[model samples]
Target: MDARYAIEIDGLTKRYGSMTALDRVSFRVERGELFGLIGPDGAGKTTLFRLLTTLMNPDEGTAAVDGLDCVASYRQIRSRVGYMPGRFSLYADLSVEENLAFFAALFGVRVADNYDLIAPIYRQIEPFRTRRAGKLSGGMKQKLALCCALIHRPSVLFLDEPTTGVDAVSRSEFWDMLAELKAKEISILVSTPYMDEADRCDRIALINEGHLLAVDSPRGIVSAYGERIYTLSGGDMYALLLAARRLPHVRRCCPFGAAHHLSVDADFDAAACRRQLADEGFADVALQPAESGIEDVFIKLMNHE
Candidate 1:
């Protein structure tokens, strides 16, 4: 009910028969804040978004947007919030311009009314206005969807994995557009499975299996990673992983791109680990201390839970 928060959720719970999609999740997004919900698929990001956007009802608890109850004021909330689901849901048969116009009409507004708000994003696809939405490329479709969502000048926006299938260049440009929107004082709640995107948000809530592991600024989460982490790589990565896990001091060892992230005790001796790998017939074994990243924190939290 606080006006300062654009969205507030308290012990929100949702279930489908025997499966619990969201388990007592709770968080708050400050007005004009750009917050991220980071997790993998089946982590319940979409379910949470649906509940907050008034498209689905929760089995327990309550949620509010801009001081309006999501359930009681569902009609009002629908008008004030813009949502772009993970999957493209635009009219495939309609042209880019038509899709934009349709959404504007549905909101009882005209495209001209919010031209200034969506101009930055709309201009990119203006040249393709006559093209059918389904015929456009993935990135182009993303831009059009975003423009349609913003055409009504909503107070808050919910983007569920908006950059999932786009290329690297498009993803970068999409985030740039979001930055401009944030500057205009519109609150945004975006979810992503990509761990690298966590650093782009003001703060992030790390969720897994319908539970919130931690919520803090990206840097704060990394700083709170209490264990000493190191990178270990060699010619035989598979064998090296098995060997590292068997080490007495090593608590966790998981593959990280080319190398394995080894979580060891503070007093762990790197020299001893190297020697142990060599004794185990592992070749080209290398070990070095590495800084913990958001991915590291996420993996650690998931393991802890």
Candidate 2:
């Protein structure tokens, strides 16, 4: 229960009957730091968030928010944290203004009481105040959800996949809003399945299939991937992928955008790789050095496990 860390977790485990959702997972978020939990679907991100938000108790181990034990201080933690779940969970039938008002009242406060904190986000949806929550566009719905979550000015914010279904422009705008919130010194714990979103956070924890892979700054993770990587294109992608895997010292080959990112050991031969691809009826094969990204690191870690 360090004062500087907004949240602390240790050996937190969650299970659903025969299936385990999170296994001996642990991490910490410093006060006012924007931390990301990066993982794909069913990687146990949501389950862990639920444990920290006090929505559900972990089957084993402990979690604390703002130094309050999640199980014992559930009431206090709920009052001090704002949460936005992956799906839009607002009252769909209520008008935008009413929805905001209702959430503010639940915390025993009025919308105007914390207007400054949510002004930038709320103003965008003010014109649609009279419209039912269900009728708003995906982007507008996103803003409204965020507004309600912040109406009480919670010290910590937990957003679970806030931009999953929104358009690119809206996604960009949402991140910008997060930046503003961070400036106000609010510790944020955000989770996303999108690998590209990892760059937006100060630090990220990569998880897969109920296992914690690695935790580090996004740039640091990529830099730590010391293996040699190359991109192979200019041939039938499927055939190239199959042929590339057979090359000497080739460890992993996965399709990335227009090319297949091929990971290899130092003993791998670039010239021989090209020659073998051509000899296998795949001419015009182009192989060039490539930089490994967060996704690459994630894949490598998952494979090792």
Q: How do the predictions measure up, each by TM-score?
A: 0.96, 0.96
lDDT of 2 by residue, 1-305 (tens): 77678999999999999999999999899999899999989999999889989989999999999989999989999999999999889999999999999999999999999999999989999999999999998888989999999999998999999978667787777888998999999999999888888898999999998998888899988887646889999858997898888899998898999999999888888999899888889988889998888888888888892
Could you give me the TM-score of model 2 versus the true structure? 0.96
Residue 1 of model 2: what lDDT? 73
The CA lDDT at 210 in model 1 is 94
lDDT per residue (tens digit) for residues 1-305 in model 1: 88789999999999999999999999999999999999999999999999999999999999999889999999999999999999999999999999999999999999999999999888889999999999998888999999988989999999999988677787777888999999999999999998888888999999999999998899888887646889999788887888899987888999999899988877788998788888889878779999888988888899982
Candidate 2, clashing residue pairs?
none
Q: What's the distance in Å from true for residue 46, model 2?
A: 1.2
Q: Which stretches of candidate 1 lie over 4 Å from their true place?
A: none
**What RMSD does model 1 have?**
1.4
For model 2, state the Cα shift of residue 155 in Å. Answer: 0.9
* lDDT value for model 1: 0.92
User: Cα deviation in Å at residue 221, candidate 2?
Assistant: 1.5
